[model samples]
Target: MGRSREKEDAESRFNSPVSISVADSSVSLLKLISILIIFVVGVVIGLVSSSHIDRYFSFRADQFNIKNIYFAADQFSSDSEKMLVNCERECALSMESFIRPLNLNHRMTDDELFWRASMVPQKEEFPFKRVPKVAFMFMTRGPLPMMPLWDRFFSGQDVDKYSIYVHALPGFELNVSNSSVFYRRQIPSQHVEWGSVSLVDGEKRLLANALLDFSNERFVLLSESCIPIYNFQTVYKYLTRSVHSFVESYDNPSRYGRGRYNRRMKPDIRLTDWRKGSQWFEIHRTLAIKIVADTKYYKLFKKYCHPSCYPDEHYIPTYLHKFYGALNANRTVTYVDWSLMGPHPATFTAVNITEGFLQSLRNNGTLCSYNTEKTSVCYLFARKFDSSALEPLLNISSQVLGF
Candidate 1:
């Protein structure tokens, strides 16, 4: 009877609804706790990933700022270096100009100072900022007795149109002529012998000084005896606006031409290269720079071109012909009447100052390349006029020169 009672109790416990409900409640609670744990783990992982991304961007931003600062510092350093170099150049030019004068204000030895000045134009890299000016360089042995005529010619001209430089005899007195445009135009000069290196030296000196003025686009080497055949306006137009230079370059195979070439000047100046022409030259700035910067041919001419070889006539003509014949006119604008039976041209007296004579110089029916094309008209300047003819020239300046 005790065994039968225990069995009935066990079966009742298993069948009870209250007991089954408690067991189901425990299973649900355990599932909820497991979900909460998974949610908490997901939040921790997302927070760590976001923080890594933020740190990466912040590091990139700092690196970019550092590179920008370096670039700015480099640019500043480069600019400072350029400024220092420019300042040094200016200071050098100033000191050179002060110690050795290429100008007319002070006395100096010829050639070297002028040579240094000429190098500035060639060696320097400068920007062009102004229109061209003409340097009217007068190479005189003594006083310019015809100053009155030149003064009248230069007068009323635009001051910016031209400049003047005169190479006179050393220790020569200016006299009472200190009031004219040619007054303070005297540069330090040395004795110049016709047909010699010294003459070439003098010409180079004038060119060197003129080249200093960047605005001086044209260089006209005139003499104390030279007189302008046209007015200032006409001359200025011819030189400044013209394409070709007025340097008389000719191939003279006569006694003075091929005969003047020395074998020592073989490579630099061959016999076939020997040329002859007038000493006077109206050169463009391009040619002027070349002239001042010459070294090889110049030295050869100085050493070998002597005695019968007139360096003044041969040096420039040959050099231009050999290298720059295309740009040169083989004729001259300065008329010299070589028809006279002598080494010198016909000297004009006051009697020869007729208006007809002046007109003949303007157009002698000879054609030459003007501006760039050929034209029938001719001369613009004349030389070998006696100083006595100044009075008569002044008398006819207004009517004839078209002033």
Candidate 2:
């Protein structure tokens, strides 16, 4: 009986439920701790990853708010290396603070700036809000003597519809008040001798500077002496809706025409290819870019054509005739009287600025094709007005000129 009791006790100790429950509780506690540790680590990792993701998207949104981007490639020279650098830098900045105005204030050379401006996109459609603006490029000798007249013309017009660029003699500053429209609008200019290639260079420089702004759709070459004969609204509509660019291109076989052709311009520019036009031209943006990008023909003309050849009158007319004849209106939008038939046209003085004379100029009765329809109203601007004519122009501006 004693031996049977000993064996039963030993079996009972091995199969006790209390001992098994204690061991199971310890293992369950270990598993719970492990699971909680793993979940906490996962939560920490998720928080870090989500924070980084938010920052990345926020940075992108801030950087790329710009509506349009014009990436001028790095093919330009070292002097213009700032163009690409500035583009890259500006990408990091807010869209409101974009490219700096590339005008007289900038120190870039004409060659470098022209090369930089020539890098236009091949695509036709713009990716931004494009309000087409006319760029009035004034190639002047010094101060604009007729500032009051221009102020009247530009007054009460939409500021966004137009831009101004002045190419005055180097070191010349416009002597206008702070409220003047022409205040601080000059571009970097070189000395332009009359009837020389330098005159054409000034025009190209103005174009290059203006091209920096992509919104300028039309380019008008004017002088300090030039004045708008019509109101700003009329001029704006006339240019923006025109089917073709107004560039007076004609064949003058006389001494002034064929006599300017240089034989050295043979293979690229032929004698038959020679053309003549007024320096004051109104062209579309496409032609403006073409003029700035032209190196081959420009070099030929600059080297060979000078003195009596007058690159300002020939280079653009001949170049466009050869390449873009179909797009040209083949007429000038500026009026000048060559009735005296002198080397220079007639200059209108204060005495000449009359209501009758101005009306006669407006209605010259010469029928020309406007938008493929015959119209008598041809000129938009006139030049060679003396400083003394400003008062008369201002007095009759509202009634006669409708400014």
Task: Provide the TM-score for each candidate, comma-separated.
Answer: 0.72, 0.76
Give the whole-model CA lDDT for all candidates, comma-separated.
0.80, 0.86
- In model 2, the worst 10-residue window by lDDT is 67-76
Model 2 TM-score is 0.76
Candidate 2 residues lying further than 4 Å off, grouped into runs, are 1-104
Q: Kindly report which residue pairs in candidate 1 clash with one another.
A: none
Q: Residue 108 lDDT in model 2? A: 88
Clashes of 1: 0
Q: Give the per-residue lDDT digits (tens) of candidate 1, residues 1-403.
A: 8999899998898779778898999999999999999999989999999999999999998999988866666566565455444545665657444433334553345556556665543345445345678889988888887778989998888877788888877788566465677756666677888868989998998888777666778988888889998999888888877788888887777776777778888887887788888987898988998888888888898999885788999899999999998888777878898997688889898999989988888877788878667876667788988999999999998998886
Local accuracy of candidate 2 as per-residue lDDT tens digits, 79-141: 445554674576556443232353246768888999877877779787667789999988888
